[model samples]
Target: MTQDLFDPFAPVPETPAKSGNTPEFSVSDLSNALKNTVEDAFSFVRVRGEISGFKRASSGHMYLALKDDKAVLDGVCWRGQAGKLGLVPEDGMEVIVTGRLTTFPGRSKYQIVIETMEVAGEGALLKLLEERKKKLAGEGLFDADRKKPIPFLPDVIGIVTSPTGAVIRDIMHRLRDRFPRRVLLWPVLVQGNGAAEQVAEAVRGFNDLLPYGHIPRPDVLIVARGGGSLEDLWAFNEEVVARAVAESDIPVISAVGHETDTTLIDFVSDLRAPTPTGAAEKAVPVRGDLIGQIEENGLRLSQAVRRLGVEKKTALESLARGLGDPKRMLEERNQMLDNWADRLPRSAVNVVSQARARLNETSARLVSPREQLSEKRGRLENAAVRLDGAMKSALQMQQARLDRASAGLRPSDAKRDVDRAGKQIMDLGARMGAAVKNTLTREAEGLARYDRLLESYSYRNVLKRGFAVVRDGAGNLVEKSADIVTGQGYDLEMGDGVTRVTAGDATTEPASTPTAPTSGGARDGDDMPVDAVASSKPETVSKPKAVKKKDPQPKDDDRQGSLL
Candidate 1:
């Protein structure tokens, strides 16, 4: 087998091309050698894999594991390199990491030292953005109610974006084309690792500006950037930037990219514009358009004023026609007064004359006092003379009868007759005196009873019976408790004196005897006497004591029942 070069077990003859001496190395030396060789072999590499176990250290260095279906690799992005990337690496996020492969000599494991990192593709970036959007949406960060209305015109507009970018240039150009506005520029990086933080700071800084400070505060705000790849425009999508936009006091207009590009800032902003130029248009109205609108309104106002003037003039003319002459009206009224004045004195004279005639007729019908008195005196005198004459005649007649009887009788008989006559006269006189005394006694008793009856009905008597006469402050008698209003002061008149007291809202009825119901109706609690209720002032009023029932007396035939 001269051709055993391919055979693994075949022994071959030694050749004469060998040096005897070789360099020796330790395990650490060998490891360092492999490390250098591997780092050099793959100096710059771009890898596409799903990121796993991504962690950012306190040192600002990012470490992660990148994995495909079958294998896994370790990767690290140092602080400087990490800061250059626009996107943050998230676990399970597919990414393209560009770096040098190197080994850690101590651990003897190889890893990629990432110089730059990006999402694997637009699809991967969108997927990550979608997941982030879902998370933020769950927190109600994208609520429509949070959106504020953009001002039609602002005093000053503050912009957070790159100062020298085309986005700013477009906004300024558009603003100049429409209405010029005062602008304040807060220069910030539009994309990259710290771009989100810069944008957030700029927004917060603008809000913190004072109106009276050296730099005037802006009335509205704009966060703008030109359209680019997802990686290039990703700063606007950061949670920090979105939160800053949402919490800004001033209304914010976001113009982040082309019309088709969507970002998180768009949802949280007060208004979203397709482009920076569009944002400028939304912020203020066109100068020419505003002038035309004002002119149109002025024309309408003038027309309205002219119409009003014509209507007022017509109303004035109509009013002038409706008004009669004031002098003529006054004359007519004066004539009426004159007619009444002329008739008044004549009518008064007629009334007085008729009254005088009636007075004369009435006087004639009346009896004069002197004549009536004289007539009465004459009648009295005539009656007295008649009475005296009749008495004398009767006495004389009696004397003659007596003389005749005396002549016809013996001395003894005459003496007896005289005695009998004397006895009869004495008896008659005694009887007259007794009757007069009895009549006087009866009349006196009647007068005493009449006086007693009068006294009983007197107000003094009523007052003496422990009853009071209540009167208001004005001295008007209050017959019922309802007559006294709260806060009013009244006088209570007892037999001895009057007392003034303030009235309270508590209502009290005069002490009423509880009568047994003939109709057998049950009495409710309200029907019970309020006298049982405590008095606010004990000294002013005494509570009513319940009266005990008395036995009924037998009815008298002539007795009249009186309701007391």
Candidate 2:
């Protein structure tokens, strides 16, 4: 190797002498000095170390340190912004933390903010039981009351686990041995970050997809995973996983982790099994045992039916034996029985003949009454029919007679009715007239009789008793006997309208003096003075005028005429 400043294959280098510092430089040049020089100087930093200190804050911030036999470097995490560290940082944990070199200005310290923290070999299994407990408890998944009861026998089953995992294989094997039936598998992640959501989705989907009625709605379910650390089984403790188990209508059999490892799903499940195989066994009855039991029950049912049949037959046989028939014992007596039977037929014939004789006698006796009854019935029926015809004819004749009578009596009855009414009116009028006449006559007769009695009885006594009469100058009868006019023309009516009397004169027997004239016409005896005519004549009657006739003209006219 020749020591030369220039390369034959490239341009020679130019040297610049050191000069005083200039007040000029590009920001890129200074940045480039730090970036490139620091990058080149600290590039490929091989950190062969052991983890000394570790911290995980409640804020999910990780703080740690890396140290070798000589020196140590501080490491920090800015919350959860990366994948999980391969190993937990504890004292004496071999690791290699890879990251870009950076400086902290607070103390101007250079450190490595870990982009990756890898442990050399296997560190330790994360036995985060407290965290697991807290996670499961926070979900309230360990409540026993939330557990559903597993169906005694399921027609359909749903298994949520890895399809290729031994868990499914074990369950299938155990189920075949127990129930020997097909099981539905929903392949899902069971050991990673998405394990809880995947397993929960599978459980919910089976429940959501279940059919109606009991035609076997995925009757039981199993959530399973192989054994691992708490982190490996942590997905089952998530709220999604726990609530999935709790919300299942079908019974959930939680088969996760080792038997010693407990999970939140195990508490909330209807039944918990140590392994997936155990869960399958718990879910179904052994098919062989079930078959045996069914066969035994069928045998017992057949035996019971046969026993009942035998008992019924025996009872029937006993009943038959108890009914003794005489025909069964009539062996040697066949001929005698036949003869007796023949005699029976002959005796029965004789009895029948006697019965027939009695029946004939009774029949003969009843025949007379029956015949008489029949004749009477026939006569009664004939009479009834004849009576009906006669009644009809009589009704028709009576109807015709009534019509004829109505027709004949119409005009005569009308005339008689009018006549009767007229007669009634005439009778009423005659009665009224007669009543009036009778009343008038009775009153007149009463008056006349009374007057006649008064005159005949009273005047007879007055005249017979020599009651004398006197006159006034005017020829008026003197009511009192003190009236004294010697001579005046006057009329003296005794009991009758006639009387004989003498005349008295004043001086001598005077002749009939003539009356003097006045304004009135000359009246015969009316104007004659008493002194003038002292003498007068009295009238004499030939026959007594019976029952005086009243003048048609008024008597007052005569008086007035005399005055005039």
Candidate 3:
């Protein structure tokens, strides 16, 4: 396999320095010498193109490449000048690169030591992410302290995903098979260009509801999709999504793509799941174990109840055995009863006299309540009559007004007015058509401008600069430095996904790099499962069945690298 000219890991592979065969020394040594001389001569050089494979290095530097369709230049930014870059770079994006062209004498490779990088798409989403990071970081949303804990026993769980995908189905299935608790779903796009924004909105929507709304607030939010290439999953990397996840009052679980793929949301989320199915598992309570435990607890309770009954019976028997004889106790009780019975007649006489007086008092009091009740009834009847009269009067007034209005408008005049209005309406309709056409024209121009901006400074331009994309199994773009945790695996879409690659960047960013499809931690293999987000997963789930499935699709499915 051919080695990468800028493989940071490999011993700088030997480059055949001087082209052509006729050489006194080997081409490798000549190439090395030429590389050194050129690098030494021009301490700096400036190039214009798009940015690709933009990455931040551990040494407080930036590493990326610049390119257009025709050519690409490997580049780097040192610690000092990297801070000066006014714009954050993105793959396939166009930009102006200013740097010192030099050769690493050790590797005999040519590269640019970057100074200033500016996007003709300047201050776009990448810059927006940096700004957002600062903003949210300031708000403690990204802080470890403020993150909500995922519910251990969520009474109800809400899922956000595409309605047709396996994500919802899987979630429903798992939830049913397990605890069979309530599983609520809010369907949304999990992939594609709009998926991130939709996902973010759905998350916010759940939080926005009052108690009596259609869907309950999710105890844990699961954003999910199947597996795909990095570009395919770019929607999850959007900063809007990342911030939404970070700022969510409910803990979020990211389940985009396969195990290897992770997005910005992963870093900001409470948890990261490998797949939609996995996300379902994470959000759901384990059914089998929970039910078994419940049953076990029930049995234990029954036993405890029996034991308590036995203990109570034994105590009652002991008290009964310790008690005095029934005959002696009966005699004492009879004597006490006789004395009280004799006094009872006198007490009864006094009580009877007092009761008689109270009865007379109660009879007198009854007259006022009866009279008051009658008066209230009379008032209610009067109120009803008044209400009826008011309603009739109002109805009559409205009828009179309508009659007057109609009377004033003679039929001829009304018809004439209607005709005039018709003519005016037609004229307005024609004008509205013209306005629509003009609006479309303006919008078309705006779209063209947007395309130009993209061409001048988007991820595509960056890729031309010899950068590569590392996608998770589900094809989501993982941009955050924090997302690429150890043990995470991914599929790389190099310049064309056509160009072969031999290595990956030694991920150094803080895993907060915001991109289109942001997410949480890494999971398992690149299993292109269906969306389980919208589907249900009760504890009674079946095994992974043999089911037909469409391959996971990317945002720009029709993309073939065309200029706008």
What are the models' TM-scores?
Answer: 0.53, 0.40, 0.35
Q: Please identify which of the two predictions, 1 or 3, would achieve the higher TM-score against the true structure.
A: 1
Model 1 bad stretches (over 4 Å): 1-23, 164-166, 189-195, 285-564
Displacement of residue 19 (Cα, Å) in model 1 is 15
Least accurate 10 contiguous residues by lDDT in model 1 = 545-554
For candidate 1, lDDT tens digit of each residue in 263-307?
999988999999999999999889999999999999999999999
lDDT, residue 435, model 2? 100
**Best candidate (score: TM-score):** 1
Flag the better candidate by lDDT, 1 or 3: 1
Model 2 clash pairs? none
TM-score of 2: 0.40
The numbered model that scores best in lDDT is 1
lDDT of 3 by residue, 92-115 (tens): 666777767877656757788887
Q: Lowest lDDT 10-mer window, candidate 3?
A: 539-548
